[model samples]
Structures are given as structure tokens and as C-alpha cells.
Target chain A: MTTIDSPPPPTLRADSLQAIGVEDMGVRYDLRFTKKTTIRRSVGQILGRGSQEPFWALRHVSLRVVHGESLAVIGPNGAGKSTLLQVLAGIIRPSEGAVDVRGHVSGLLTLGAGFDRELSGRDNILLGGAFLGLEDEVTRRLLPSIIEYAELGDFIDAPIKTYSSGMRARLGFAIATSVDPDILLLDEVLATGDANFRAKSKARVIEIVRAAKAVVLVTHDMSWVTEYSNRAVLIEKGRLIMEGDPAEVVALHRQHTDEARAASAAAATAAGLDPGIAGQGRR
Target chain B: MSVTSEVPAAFRNAADDPGAARLIREGLADIVSRRRLVRYLVQADMRKRGADTILGNFWWVLDPLLQMLVYVIFVTIVVSRKTPDYPLFIFAAILPWKWFTTSVVDATSAVASQDRLIKQIQFPKLVLPVATTTAGVVGFAFGLIPLAGLMLFYADRISPFLLLVPLIAVVQYVFTLAFSILLAAGNVFFRDLGNVARHVLRLWWFLSPGLYSLAVLDEVHVVQANPILKVIANANPFAILFEAYRKVIYGAPTSPPGLPDWTSLAVLLLVSVGFLALSTVVFKRLEPSFAKVL
Candidate 1:
């Protein structure tokens, strides 16, 4: 029923939709101990010989998030979910392949990760806002809204160290979400807050997912994955093992976890060790 | 539901780490574009420092003033030196020396100290050292308050040449920045650089013409015997900077102040500007691995 003269919406363009793209990217860490080497010796080391081992944190993983879509990344601890988000946020350079993010990305890589505890929450908000590429005046104009979002009350003017851990996470979420970023990357940012804040933050994330050009979130919350995300990615041992509807990806993730647990239990029996004791420790 | 695997033409590819030329060009470009941000960070850093003390920013003025007094006392009574207007002479060097030392110490730890921020945020990490170095400018300006008062004590020493203080300082700032970005990047790999930097800076200050003028160095038999030693002494950036500072601030005890060796300073500026470019490239080359290491 639209007239031929009516122009196409800007959202229909591929440029707007291709908010983030990664192609077969990998990250490798030099697994050597941090040895004290002087400038000359290090230059020599860089020139050629090295006995250090390398570990790949992410390998052969291609991912993309277009506008108007939110992808949930569900993976076991140490499965490189955080690393993938960092890569998309352009914090970590990939060792192989390419990554392209189309917009100003606001990544909550670690909740309240950069706050200087000695400074006031207000000061940290300004600092965080600057780090997010917001001008000082812009951050100042947005201050009331951010403070309101955190609901820290007078505590907003207090040093961050005095605030409880939950308060810190709340402030982090508030500052991170202050800007309506084109791409939003969240890494278990809602895991720490109390039930009320978690509910509120979850609702906020849902709203952002609808508004932001693209969003990538890493979470262990199974219900959240199935209920909220347009798609889910399952990462295992530094690889994207599955990607599909949230329900199916979550199913595969659970199945893999169960199998891995069973295998560990079987190995514990072979070693004549108590599975209860061993599993209780690390896992 | 559809996701384009192709990287849009507008999207920058991270796989291609830039060459040295581009790294230097882009590094400077980033600094220019983010100059306002650098100012904000510098102010934040100064505010953080001010929050830690009773006197706070006042110390910036007082610390140098007190140090000048101590040096005056030592030189006149303890050492028995007859350097004229000793307070003005030493203060001239002390003021710039404090700026240099603090800039070095701060920049050395700038990257490693912000491990959390570097890990979490994606802004230019170079801003840390640049901001830290720039913060010294504020402290230096505050130090000048005492410099003004000290100049009043030796009223005869003040001259029109005093205005050249900023011009000489601009060269010193460039030299300090070259050292800063290099040290900041190196410190990430070698955390001990933080401690090593302080000791090296102390030795550097003494080696410079801070405590003694170049004319005094020329009087020493060892310096006079070898032309190469004289050449090396003159080659020091501080040798040029301190001499330039002395010309405008202290002047000769016998005659009025004269213009500094402009040729030397111009040469130093050019060298520093080139070194800064090289350092920026080194910094950008190491930047990608900073998040991983930190």
C-alpha cells in the first residue's frame, strides 16, 4: 500500500544492518612465563629464536550481528566467550582472519572493571564516559540520567570503594548503558546485582536489544537465552561449535555439559579418586 | 535473520596492522582528534592526586619552593659554593627537572597501572601516557608561582628573555613525550621499568647541567682535555634545555641575560619531533597485545 515515490527506509541498507562481522578469526596467547628481559635481549628474541609455547584462545570462529538483532553467547567458563566479545569490541587483535565492527561499540567486558575505587562513583562515571568516547559536556548532560538509572542515591557522590560489590556493578551497568551505542556487548553484566536490579537490568537489556543496531551478550542464564535472544551461539574449547535458535543451542550446550561431566566422572573412577570431591573443587 | 558475512567497505579490518608510516600518521591523527579527551583525562588525574592530600594542589607550588630553599641552604653553608643568586639558578633547573622526573615516572607506569581499564575499554591506550605526561604541565605551571616569587628575591636577574621559558619548555615537553610513549609501551612487557625509571631519571638529572652550568663543566680538566666529551655533554637534550633555561632565568652573574643558543634548541626540537614519531610507531606496534598481556 506504499506509494512508489516513498523512499526506502535507511534500515533496509546493508551498511546499517551489517553492524558487526567476524570471519574465521583466531587469538593465540604466548604461553610463556613473563620473564624479565631488557630492551636489547627482547629485541634479539624478537629477531628470531623462541622456545615459548602458544595457546589458541579462539580459533576458526566467524560471527556476524546485523542491526535489529541480538545474539546470545552461551558457553562454559573459559570457553572464550569473553574473548569473542573483546574481539568484536576491537580490544583484542585477532591472530588470524578479520573482524569488522561498524559502529561505536560499548562493551561491558567486565562489570565495573575499570573503576578506580578511590574515586567517587560520579568521577568514575565521568572517566568511564570519556573512555566510551563521550565528550565531557555530553557526559555531564547525561549524568542525571545515569545516576537515576543506577539509583545509587547519595552514594553516587561517595568513593566507589565504600559501595558494595552489587552497587559497583550497578554503577557499571548504568555508565555503560548511558550512551545509546550502536553496538552493545555485554559479558555477564547482570550476574552480580540483587534480584530487583537483575530484573530491572534484564528489562533494560531487552529494551536495548530492541533499539541498538546490534547486541552480543554472553550469559550462563539458560532461561534468558531461550526467552530473549534472536539466536544463540555455543562455544566450546575455543571454537564456535553451534549456532541456531536459542532453544536448540541451549539444548546442545546442556548436552555437551552433561557428556563432559560424565566423562570426567568416568576418568575419576579410573584414577580411583572420589568424583564428589574432585568435581566439588574446580568445576 | 540474515547476517552478511562480507565485511562492509566502510568497516575497518583488524587483521591488517598498519605499517610504520601509517601507524605514525594515524597515531598523530588519533592524538589530534582526541586532544579534548586527553585534556579530560589529565584533569581527572590531577583531581585524583589532589583528592589524596590535605594541602592538595598547593603542594605543587610549595614542594618546589621548599626544595629551592634546601638547595640554597646546602650550597651557601654546607657546600661553600659562591654561585651568585644560587636560588634563582638552582630553581630554574629544579622546576623543569621536577616536570621531567614526574612525567617519566608517571608515564612508565601509565599502561601497567591501568590494567583494568586497558582490559575493559577500547579507547586509544596511548592516551594514558600522553595524559600522564601532560598532567606534569599543570604541575609545572603551579611551580612557576614559586618561580615568580623567587625571581622577586633576585630582581636584577629578571629580564625580557624570561618569556622564552615557554619556548624552551615546549622543546622539553617534546623530549619528555618521546621518552614517555616508549617507556609506557616497554613497561607493559617489563613491569620493573617502573622502578628502573626512577633511578635512571635521578642519574640523568645529575648528568645534565641541572646542578652545574655548562661553563662549569668546561672548567673541569677531564671535560676540557677531550673535545669528544665536550661534544657529548652538549649533545644532551637537557644540556641544551638547561642552558636555554639558565639564559632566560639566571643569566650570567656578571652580565645581563642573553638569548639562548637558538641553533642548538632548533636542532633538539627537530630531533625530538622525529623521535616522537618513531616512539609513536613503537607504541602502536605493541598496542594490540596490551589487553592480552595486561
Candidate 2:
């Protein structure tokens, strides 16, 4: 329908996506124990305090993500979903396991990840751009587009601390998308902004992912995963329980969670009815 | 867990942990490329303190000059029985010491203060403290001009040893950088270090030869026996730098008392290099968890 004289719409070129590999990734956090100081305890422990404790946050996870693949990591809170994202982002090393990443990996752990409250919204865009590893000149050249996309007119020059959460989200989302990344990691960022802006942000992600090559989206929203992701990985207690079709994975996760909850409920009911079962509780 | 299945079949597997090596390579490159950010941050910091003031950056010069005036007046009235021009002598020593003390203290807080930036950015963690030190050095250099004028006002002859200021400043800066990194890393784990740092600075100020001459202490062998005081003073980079300042301003005949010429400078240089290296290693090691801890 377009005229010959008019220029054609831009096409997303290939060679943008690349493969990422994770092998037997494990992470452990070591915690030092501090003895509670009581007068009696301190008198007794002129000797010494107790030893520290060690806990595993992630234990022996393995997965392979190929070129142009979308993987959704879904779990309840504190299920090591964000830890896995951070490991992939190269923010932290796995205590054990190997990760091989090809090409640029960009992430949104949360919106306004690098917003300087003292700096203006305009300056934060530059700071965020630099923090994300874009060349200064490239950021300068893209400045106009970033400002426009933020849709945060007039407020751009004001200090960012003055901004509302939605405004901050707009600025963060704009700067993150300004650079085309090979591997995109999103963690609960799309839920921010107003309904109108959220629609725009989702459209932008769809537009970006068409050429994203490899993406890992960590979200609690099963519907969003089933709609957007090609495959899904269900996580529970820091282990990968299932990985396959998004619909099947989401269904499995729900069923599994429900069954565990029901089982716990049934056990509680039985314990309440039986005095013998309740008798062992104090011990 | 076999490597052959994960890596490309065409490429041969090697003994090296390529994942860690790759992280380092990319991380270093990314940090190196963000040099502009360091410049921006430094500029931002300079503006942060002085921008709205009427005097702008002249405050850097004025801030220390005013302190020197107070010290000069107090010492001339109460402490010194000297024929020497006390104001010029104190000004010479005080300027550099102030720079060293303030720079290290500021740089120590630099990394911790930028808790948000540390969480968000992937840039080199060293850049924060380095930028802090750089800002202090720049301000300190500006403060020196006023001190130079005061020296001339007293009709004291400036020595060619003045040329060594740049060289000495670098050594002092390197030492301060090392201390800042260690302190900053410590401060991240325990906020109490910040409060302790203030007390440490106070003790250092009194113990240092900044306010008084080290030459006077020779009369008291008690000072010689107290190696803790002696070591803290003589081993301090500021002590060496301030002694050199005294040498230039007062024309103190011999080199600063306790330190050996080659040995002291060499010790300082080695410590500076070692600290820089240690700070880099420690900062990088601690960096992976900074985001979470913050």
C-alpha cells in the first residue's frame, strides 16, 4: 500500500541473537554466626563463640538456551529466580557451575536500577546508558530518541528524586531499550508504569524481542509467560522441576503448588484430629 | 556436566576455566571503556560542594587558609617560643597533611556512599575511590596556591625541593588510595568504621608532626622508646611529605629526623604499589556481592 517514493519500514536484521549455555550452576552463601551476648553467656564464653552456618541458595542447576530462544523462569518469591538471572548477567559468579555467554547481555533487575536521585532525569539517562556498557558517543547520539521514548516531557531536566515511580519506570525502560542487546534479561519490570504506558512498554518489548536472539524473562505472571515466551522453566525450592511448552509448564507449576498446599492442609487436619500426632509437637 | 556437550564441538576444551577468564576480560574492558564516567563523576562532585556558593571553587583555597590562620594564631599566642615565622612554617606542613587526611577519609566513604551506584552499575569498583581521591587531590592542589603565597609573604626562600611536590603527591595519593580501598571495603561490612574513621583522623592529626616539629621530640628519649607512636608518625606518608614541606619552608638543615632517604621512600613506594594491587584484588572479590548486600 505504500508509495514507491516513500521509504520502506525498517526491518530487523538477523545475526542479533546468539546461544547461551549454563552447566551445573550452583551458588552457596556462607553466614557467620554471632553469639547473643548475655551476661551469663558471656561469662561462660570467655572461651569462644559458636561456628558459622552455610546455606545453599542454588544447588546444581543445568540448562542450555539456544539462539533466538525465549525462556521464562517462573517460581514463587525467594526461589532463586533472581539469583539465576544475576548469575547469567555476570553480576555474581556461581559458587559452582559453568556459564558460557556469547554476545551482549542486558538486564532490568528492577526499574530505575541506576537512577541517581541527585541527578536530573536527563542525566540519569546518560548514567544508565554508561552503566549498561554503551559507549558515551553512542549515548550522546541516541539521546534525542531516548528522551522522546521516555514520554517524560518537561520533567526530564528535574532531579529524579522528584519523580513518581511511574515516571522513573518510564525513564528506566526508555534507556534500557535504547541499546539493542543480544541477550535480554527481564525481572518484573513490565508490571510498572500506568496502563497506557504498560501497553506501550509491552509493545516495545515485543518489537525488541523480534530481534533479541536470546531472552530470559523471570516473571510471576503465568499468563504473560504463556503468551510471550516460547518455552518455560518451572522452579521450586531452587530446582528446575519442568521445562517445555509455556502452557504445559504453567499448568504443571499450578497443579504442583496446589497439591503441595493440599497435602500440607490434610496433614494439619489429621494432626489436629489425633492427640498422638499433636503430642510429639513440643519435642 | 561434561564440557564437550556444552561447548562447541569444533573447538577443543582446554584446562583453563574459560568462564571466569571471560568474565574478567569483559569486566575489565567494560570498566576501562567507562573512563568518561569517572571524569563526569569527578566534575559532578566538585560542583556538588561549591556550585551554589558565591566564591565557587575559591572556597577550596579559602577553606584551608582559614584553618591555617586559626592554627597560626593559636600557636603563636600559646605554644611556640620560636624566633621562626610560625605562620609560614605551620602553613607549609598543614596544607599537605590536610590534603592527605581529607582525601583518604573522603575516598574511604566514596564507595559506601554510592550504595545505589554500586548496586546498579557494572563499572570498575576502583573508579569510585579513585574518583574521590582525584577530586580531593584537585581541591588540595588548588589550596596549595594560597599556601605558596603565604610562604612568599614571610620572605622565606623557596627550595628546589618544591619541584618534588608532584612526585611526593603521587606517592601520597597512591598510599591514600590503598588505605581508602581497605577502609571502604571494611565500611561496607560494618558501618561503624565510618565513625571510627573520624576518631582515627583525630588521633592521627595530634600524633603527626603537622602541628609541631619532629625535631623537638629528640630531647625526649621517651618518644624514641614508644615505637607505636614513632612508627605511626614516621611510617605515615603524610609525615614524610610534611617533613619535606618543612625542609623546603623552614630550611631545616638535615633531612626529616628518623627516616632513611632510600629506605623510607622505597618502603612507601612498595607499600603504595602493594596497596593498589591488594585493593584491586579485594575490591573485585567483594564486588560480586555488593549489589545484594547493599
Candidate 3:
């Protein structure tokens, strides 16, 4: 057989008392190999072994979710919304702090994360199932319902690349929700697909959200934050800024955005720049 | 029913660098527990490689046969070497060499290429290299059909020592696996590694006994006079492995098919297992950063 890090060690463990727990968690990313600066700094390093700057994608964030709870995380772009979900999903181990998660976690963290575009939906389903460490037979038993939910019909046999973006999202949602794990983590996915598909999926999401012991959703849609979650937390600049009723959290996030825009607009006006353009800049 | 990490902050970060014992336990445990993922990934890999092609699986059979012929013509006509049953002799080295090169090359990018998958899901990153390397075994298995045909065609070269093929392969597997883990993790931190690996592997093939066995190397004064070069030549695992393949497949120009060098095989096994443990430690140490870097 072939053979196959880190310390604070981000500590994410499982405890029976809580569905998920994070204590002083943080994830630092190296700027050199990051998507934006990767090319420039990588070349710089090759030319003259330069020191790499580390960006704290998340910092001093602690959160907890208990069984029978649904928590929504909302934030603007690059606010580490997905990063928080990634930590909860155990895809990322924090550089600092500890986390405990109680049971099996299944998620469609990113719409296209686990899919192989060249494989048929059938193959990708099995592939995704295998990613969750399920055997072929166990995945096969769940196939019919996944297909029905995805509504791929004959397209289930076609390569995933040929499926519309909506179909892809549907298939992803189906797989994540199908396994009935104790906890479900979803990332910016509920807003996908056509209206009819969305309507049908809302019911499925509700069913899953209610059935699973705990559910964590990351989305930009304010409506979804309130409509889907009983408890919500707002994230901004990698910090948990607020946590409360979903509607109140969503409202506060909106107020903060508007205030940020107004402040930027005022600064623009004082500097003889266009307020409209400046308002858009911060977002 | 409630609990909190009682570990002090200083000690909490201790997990950042696991002890050797824990690293070994986790490394072995991850590979063992998630074997189904490896099998599935290997199947998916083979399916993708052969998809939508007219010849499909036939290419696996045809590829080595065609390469053997090319090498045979190059050796006999271009180099003017006269060797009988050259096809079987060369074919033996070709199969295992191909497996080693292809698996290692694949492992170099295995984890790096799954950047999105790694970031979005949680599982042992160990599975990535394990899966890619095991897929090579399947590809190598496909190459065996040609090996069988060559043996049957040259019935005179057949020997009971051929049963030792799997035994020899086991050694090669252990060695390739150790290197694959190292390469897989190293390539993530240094993107240039994959590019360098291709050229290095090609040079390695040339330096190994693929084209000429140790029997020939012993005849060279440059290699014989320099004890360091002589030891390096013997230390090349492929030197021992390729020579073993040749021994069981047909043997040197003067000798008949026979058992491989067991002493060498055993040494390779122990060294490879040690290297595998070391590679696993390195791989795991770098793993948490993979989702970050990639």
C-alpha cells in the first residue's frame, strides 16, 4: 500500500454536548501563494528568496452550535464567511484556538468543490459519496432519491459539464442533504437554480434543517438568513461582530453596510471624488 | 454532558507539531481507514483516462509493446548490440519503470490539483497521494497483459521464478510509495517540483539499469574505479529492481531466468518503509497548510 501539520494547532474536536464548538480559532494564509499575489511573489521568491507575509483570514473567533440548532453566518465578500464554514467543516485547522464538533458533518461547502466535470452526474454522486467515506453500495442505495431531488432524469447519465449551472447546484445540494449527517454545513448555495428548483429545494432544505441535529449555513442573501435560520451571527473582517435573532442580525448587517457606504461617500465628497463610485468601492 | 479543552494555551498549540508516535499512528490509520476512497479514486482515474477513446483499454496493451519495439530497434540497429530475446528482457524493466515514473509524476500534483476539494471538505490529506499511487498499480496491472504475451511468445525464456514478479513488485511499490508521499507534499510548497520531477525521472531512468544492467556497469572503468559511483549505482533501487526483473524475465546475456537478489530486495524494503514513515511525517506536518497554500 502507498503511505501518505500543524499545531494550534487549531483545535476542532467533537464533544457530545455541542454539535460544533470553536474557541479562539484563527486561520492565517500566506500572501505569497494566495490567489492574487501568487504569481508576483512566487517569482520574487525564486529570484531572491523573499519573506512571505501571512494574512489572518480568521482571528480570535469563537462560536458554538448545539443540537437542534440552525446558525446562519452572513458577511460581505472576503469577510471570512466561507473560512468560518471551512473551519467548522474541519477543512481548515485554526492556527490558534480549539474547536469541538459532536458528530458526522456533511456539506456542500462550495457549489463545485467535489464535482468532476467530465464524469456523469451518476459518477460524481458516487464520487461525492466516496469523498464522505461512504462505500459504493451505501451510496447506491441513496441514488434514486438524489436523482429525484436533482431531477436530472436522463441527464443523470450525461457528463456534469453538460449540465446547466442550476443542475450542478441541484446535484450538489442533493448530495449534501441526502446523507442525513448529524450536522449539515452549506455555503452560499441556497440561492442557486431556477425559481421552480429553488422553491422545491426550499422544502428539502427545511426538511433537512429540521431533521439534522444542527445546521450551519453561509449565505449573502438576507432573506435566506432570516427565513432559514433561528439563530444568526454576523461576520466582518474575520471577526464575529454580532449574534442574535436572524432578522435583527440581518438588519444590523444592512445598517452597518449603509453606514460604511455613507462614511465612504462623505470622504469622497470631501475629496472631490464621486460619492456613487466611492460608495461602491468599500463593498 | 458539557466539556471544554482544559489544555493550557501553550500546550494547546502542541498539536501543531505532533509527536513522532502520533504522526505514525495517524498516518497509518488514515491510509487504512479510508481505503475505499483510494479504490474509488483509482477507478475514477482509469475511467477518465480511457474515456471516449476508440481504442480505450487497448492502448494500455499497445503502448508498451510499441515502446519495446522502438527500444529494440534503437538498441540493435542504432547501437549495434546483438542480444537474443531482447524484447522480453527489456519488457520486464519497462513495465515497473513505467509504473514508478507515472505514479510519482501523478503524485506530484495529486494534492495540489485538488485544491478546491481539499479546502471545501475535511478528510485526511494522506488519501490524495495514496490514491494516485495506487492508481498506478492498476495501470501497471494493465501493462501485465503485454508481459504475459511476451513470456508466452518466448516460451524458452519462461521460468518458475516468474512467480516472483509480485514479490519484486511489492518492493518497488514500497519504494515508489515512500517517494510519492514526499513528492506529493513537496510539490505543494514548491510548484516547480512537478516540473523538475519530470526531467529528474527521465534522467533517473537513464541512470538506472533500464537500458543496461549492473552486469554491464561492472565492465566500465569509470564506474568501477570510483567506489562512490559504484555504490551509488548499486544504491539505485531500480538497479536492484530492474536487474531482478531481468533475472526472472530472461536474465543477463550469459545467465538463465532465476530468483532475484533477496538481500537487495530486503534492504530496499526496510529502507523504503523507513522513508515512508519519514515522508508521512513530512506530509502530515505540511497538510494543514495545504488548504491554506493551495
Model 2 lDDT tens row, A180-227: 777778888789988999999988887767677678989988877877
Q: How do the residues A1-283 of candidate 1 rate in per-residue lDDT, one tens digit apiece?
A: 1111121245574654687788888999874425444555565667776756688999999977777777899989999999998888778888998887876677766778888887898888877877777766788988999999998999988989899988988898888777777788988877769999988987787777667777798999888777767788999989999997888899999999999899777767755666566565544
Q: How well is candidate 2 docked (DockQ)?
A: 0.20
Per-model TM-score, in order, reads: 0.90, 0.82, 0.89
Over B231-253, each residue of candidate 1 has an lDDT whose tens digit, in order, gives: 89899999999889999988976
What docking class should model 3 receive?
A: acceptable
C-alpha RMSD by candidate, in order? 5.3, 7.3, 7.0
- lDDT for position B83 in model 2: 37
Per-residue lDDT over B1-294 for candidate 2, one digit per residue giving the tens place of the 0 to 100 score = 111111121111112244444544543553466677777777767866664589988988888889888987777777665636667667777777777777777876777777765644445666677777778888878977897777676653565656666766777777877787777766665556667888888888777777777766665587777856665667776677677666655555333222225557667878888777666666666766565555
Which ranges of candidate 3 are over 4 A from the true structure? A1-17, A35-49, A266-283, B1-16
Model 3 chain A, TM-score vs. native: 0.83
In model 1, what is the error at residue B101, expressed in angstroms?
A: 0.5
Q: Whole-model lDDT, candidate 3?
A: 0.81
True contacts kept of each: 0.42, 0.14, 0.33
- Residue-level lDDT of model 3, residues B1-294, one tens digit each, is 111111111122314667777998988888877777787788888888888899997888888889889889999889987777888878888999989988999999898899888888777889989998999998888999989988888887778988888889898898999999999988877787887899999999889888676777788899778868978999999999999888998877767898788999999999999999899998988888788878
